[model samples]
Target: MDKALRGKFGKLLARYRVTKGKGFRLADHDPADTAGLDYSKAEARELLARGTALLAEEQSKLYAQDQWSVLLLLQAMDAAGKDGTIKHVMSGVNPQGCDVFSFKAPHAEELDHDFLWRHVRRLPARGHIGIHNRSWYEEVLVVRVHKEILARQKLPDAVRGKRLFDRRLEDIAAFERYLANQGTAIVKVFLHISRKEQKKRFLERIDHPEKNWKFSSRDVAERGYWEDYMQAYETAIRATAAPHAPWYVVPADNKWFTRLVVAGALLATMGSLDLAFPTLPAEEKAKLAEARAKLVAEKD
Candidate 1:
């Protein structure tokens, strides 16, 4: 049988539960699920490279038309290959039109506003792509995992319990809905790497001189809270997955496979958008033909 088409970004986004006609197939996506795809490592790499080019092409059209935006939100535990995925899958895009942000510990100003405040400032400009290495979802992940961090939100007494957390979910839904209504394509991917895999990757960072800079004591502390973090991810994925903005739990046990999956999912999403380059007017087409004729006349 021919390889199945993953279809377009609009289709996949519509598959999210919150979309008007969305169904259940989009939810409960298994990280290990490969959708019966069969290709060698070489083939997968080539496909990934092609996917990047295709994404860039569509993005270029979107940019020229000044039509839409894509905000790719990557969430994962440390060593889950978020950086690797971004570097490889987005490599073909023009850097000028793409922006990446790493959301770290918040400052005083960030604390003063709502959890999504900092992210609003970093939204992608029209016709550009924004890649968030770690997004506002940390409010759900880190804060939910560590209640002490929740104190920073300064919730009211009655809303201080799980209700407060549910409210954040509602806020996220509203925020994403607003983005979709404003023509933003939201892609949230979770790199699911096992504890053993994370440990191995962490060891590599420690043993390699060049990679040593990536090692931190904080990673150890974070791993210690593995169970809590897993629960946090499960809860966040279950709650925030809307049809307008869906989450894909990409398996990160194999870095190359993870990169391929990220690229494949990206191509699937961008393709779903049904984008195209704007057509030129008749006078402009004639002007371009005349210019090309002049260029050919002057050719060496």
Candidate 2:
């Protein structure tokens, strides 16, 4: 919340932010990178606590201003810490001012419409922050990785081809730009987790009874297509990264570090919005003064 801490976070955001995707390589980013921060897990936790507190303050202003909204998109492979990041980074925010949506396989009705239909309808209203666990990017990620899924979409013959992914990416970029113009600040994050780290997490889930429910057999099946997913992510990022909808490739091997970066990214985005609590007009101030006088004269 202080100027010094905010500056530190600003620098961290610059390190991972991708506004232009030209020459971007997923391999260029280290999954274990901490941006030279040597803080222990406890130290990181304390920092995150502060960040969340500041975020809550900023969120209050955003809510009261009742104009700008924020959309945070988290995209990653299985076991990449998306859920944990959301839970920890947004802990201090008021639930009424925030909305979280997790997108899985599309339902029959969802598939009936275009890919972005379901997600578009779930967007947050003005004065709220919307978090998407996995979003329309899945059309280019999962659907791209698995061609069979695309066939199930029932697209017209004219729009079904090898170039469809590129076309979809262009549409996504335009959609995000439109949202940005309409007062929604967009921040997209990719939890960059290594294959080794993901495997370890999967094993932990299998071994821990408490985490068993979080484990899905399909998760392991998808692991076999790790490279495919990575390629899809790289392509999507390259196509859609823009000033209005920047992407943060946050490292996920270290959950603490990942959480800190996520918190910082959201903090930076909300901070840039110049959010402030609305000021009362002259008439409203007079009304409030009258109400205060009446309250003072009344019994406790």
Candidate 3:
């Protein structure tokens, strides 16, 4: 995508993120549809710059309203450009109000609690934005695919069958609904990059001097399970999608498009809350006018 179009795309996505939900669906992101967009590097640079500014403006409005929170859950396989998406799409947000949590292997304390326990503790406060690098969905994806992990959870032997999977899903849905009721709007993005794209990015990590630090042997190991992860992602998206918190399958083969879709999803989710500043009482408004007049007179 060219710089101008990239700006257009970014700006549009920002608008979509704040004002979305009218026609949003988790399955609407189709990789096939995104492959053909052609834009130059110069164009992308311009879009990225403007998109960044617009994001700040949108965030200001969201904060001033202080009525809701926007949660972005990004789930993808290794070598799937999660870092790049975070860098570009979220660069414009306020640092104080935006929280990005990356979940890795469970620690001793994490293992002691229920799977949802750690994640629930990190839920974004009102008027804030929370981005989960990998999330509670990991319980289903990593555990279901590798059942042995469940043995560590130490649930009772009676409820130890495949029904455990169903229980996890229910917990996720119920948790999300409770968040919604408490004034959070969530948008989940599944970055859909082809295996070919994955290989290319992996090579970039190896071949590029600056990116060499990013490559790991385990990345290749996880790459081997790409198909399994895809199926897991598909199932999770279908199961956890709810009216308050829906997922968007973003075509992430192109970094620019990926940023746009993710940004759009964020703006859309936040915009849905009918956000506005609290109305000033008439007496307070008059007092504020008098205060300002006094300040102006003192300055004179």
Candidate 4:
């Protein structure tokens, strides 16, 4: 990305980035907000293409450097565009250097371990990027909204009190801090879609034959607890938001804007790492020169 675009994205990111969640209110963020950008859908798509190209370039450097890794946590309500955002924003990235994990309800084995165990096992290796469609935060968000899900975890009575969510948030923050200390950059995004928009999308899924497979009765059931989920999200964001693991409350009503912000957030995160291709040592450089001479000497 050019410096001008980078600057524009930086400013846009600043508007939504929450490093400290004190006094943060989800209601304060307008789901329809586009940061006042009047770009048409085509214009936004072109800009996203540029951003993804730059992201691919940056990912190559990150892989060659083989030092730091990136973990992106995307959390949102049903039909909030998390899947589309990942598909579009990461379109240009090298698949070998990136991994995407979509976390649904826990299975029997997953329930046997602590909340973070399953997620920890799926973490990215060094010099790679891991995208979690819905991550461990679900332990706080979904589990909090639906208390029965927490009961299914079968935790000891001592840890299953009113402060359970708080303890989980603390653990999450500490875990993220540990990852940051170990050369991982964490970017958490909450796709803030309005209830009205969600209803419209749900109806679209019901009406369109191609989208029918995406619809689920469970998704509609969860809609009844919308307010509860919002509160859970707000609390979790407040507790876990930190310098090491910041949250971008991206507006999801507009898919184009959502994709742009997500791309910008990633670009800004990787840009902050100052990633670059590794420099060859003097010995390796000499060996490469010899290999090149041997190859040039051969008649092809």
Candidate 5:
């Protein structure tokens, strides 16, 4: 993308970003808000294609340079299209340079350590991209909404009180800052979808034989806590959003637009880093030239 388009894309994504002190309120953003986009469906697809191509190039450069890492955190209510967003936006990236981790219920071994321990161990090394379907923020989000779960984590009394959620948010901010300082760029996204939209998706899953396996009793039970989840999301995002690790509250009722916004946000973030493929060493260049000369001279 050209400079003008890049700037435009950045500004568009910024509309949904929750930076420090901005304070995210889910109610303020409509899950179906496509007013910021003037493009048609086809145009949105084109934009996503351009972004996917740019992301591929950037990922290659990132791998070659081995100087930086990226972490993409996608958090959402059920049926908000997190899986589809990941599948479409990252389709062009080399699998070798990417790692996708889905954090579900904590395994026994995982619970043995700090909340961030499992995720910390799974962070991408330099020159790689790590995508978390659900992340450590779940500790504050789900656990905060369901206080019983938090109590069961066996955390110290220091973090168990009326201000417990605030303390966890503080810890999250500190953790992200540390990651940023250590050469990781964080792009956190909350796929914001309306209750009605979620209901529609759930109905589809129930009615379609192919999608029947996607629905479960838990999903229905969780639907009852929609307001609680939104509140938790607002609290966590407001407390943790930072310059280096910003949160984007994406309107996800429209899957196509969500992909475009996500792809655009990633392009802008990586482009801002000014990534470039490393130049070969003088000796390596010489060896390559010699090898080329030998191949040219041989009968083909």
Candidate 6:
């Protein structure tokens, strides 16, 4: 992607990027803010197609160099289009070079270790992309909202309550900073969707037989804690967002626009890495030329 192309969408990302010490308040960001963007669904589709092509090319270089890795963690409320964002934004990347992990309630075994242990284990190796649908932040978001879940973690009394949330936030910040230092670029995306939009999606899921499987009563129950979840997300983003691991609060009301922003942002981030295919040494190039000549002669 050229700098000029990236700059256009970069503005969209900059508008939503939550910088550390900026006193981020989710209430201030509208889920439908498409300021300065006058693209139709068709236009967004075209933009996404271009962005994904660039992303695929960048990912190929990333794999060939085998130097750096990328981790994209997407967090959102239910029906906020997290799945759609990942599927559409990453559609062009080679599956072999990318992996997606969806985190749900922790299994009994996962609870035995630190909250981040499971997530850290899933980090992508060098020269690949890792996508976390829901991530370790659930410890701070869901668990914090529903306090009873925190008691199950069996933490020492000294680290319970606000202390626990604060400590976990610190751990996340340090963890991301360390990953950045170690050549793993991190992009955290929060798909901001309105409660009304969620309800609409949920009803659609119920009304359509093909989508019925996606509707769950649990999602409905959680809707009652909308305020709690919002506060938790706002606090978590504010505490953990840093230069190395910035958070992009993308508007989720328009799925097409969301996909475009996500794809464009990812491409811009990976492009900054200056990833390139590995160069062969002079001797290796000479040997390859000789081998190619021999193969051509044999074929003739």
Model 4 Cα lDDT, one tens digit per residue, 1-300: 579889989989999999998999999999999999999988999999999999999999999999999999999999999999999999999999999999989999999999999999999999999999999999998888778887789899988888888888999999999999999999999999999999999999999999999999999999999999999999989998998899999999999999999999999999999898888999999999999999999998
In candidate 4, stretches whose alpha carbon ends up further than 4 angstroms from where it belongs are none
lDDT of 1 by residue, 164-214 (tens): 777887789789999999999998888878888889989999999999999
Sort by lDDT, top down from the best:
4, 2, 6, 5, 1, 3
- Candidate 5 regions exceeding 4 Å error are none
Deviation in angstroms for 132 in model 2? Answer: 0.7
Candidates' TM-scores?
0.85, 0.98, 0.86, 0.98, 0.94, 0.97
Q: Model 1 off-target regions past 4 Å?
A: 1-40, 153-159, 286-300
lDDT of 2: 0.94
Evaluate residue 190 in candidate 6 and report its C-alpha lDDT on the 0 to 100 scale.
94
* Per-residue alpha-carbon lDDT of candidate 2 for residues 29-60, written as tens digits (9 for 90 to 100): 99999999899878988889999999999999
- The residue-by-residue lDDT of candidate 6 on 120-171, one tens digit each, is 8899999999999999899889989988997778777866665878888888
Q: Report lDDT (CA) for all predictions.
A: 0.77, 0.94, 0.74, 0.94, 0.88, 0.89
Worst 10 residues of 2 by lDDT: 1-10
Q: What TM-score would you give candidate 2 relative to the actual structure?
A: 0.98
lDDT of 1 at 122: 97
RMSD of each predicted structure = 4.2, 0.9, 4.6, 0.9, 1.7, 1.3
lDDT of 3 by residue, 1-300 (tens): 134534545454432231223344434455534545565877766666666676666677778778788888888877777888989888988898889999997888998888888998988888888889999999989887778887788777987886787788878988888888888888877777788888888899899999999889888887777777777766666677666777666777778777766765665555556666678999999999999999988944
Assess candidate 3 and give its TM-score to the true structure.
0.86
* TM-score-best of 1 and 4: 4
Clashes of each: 6, 0, 21, 0, 0, 0
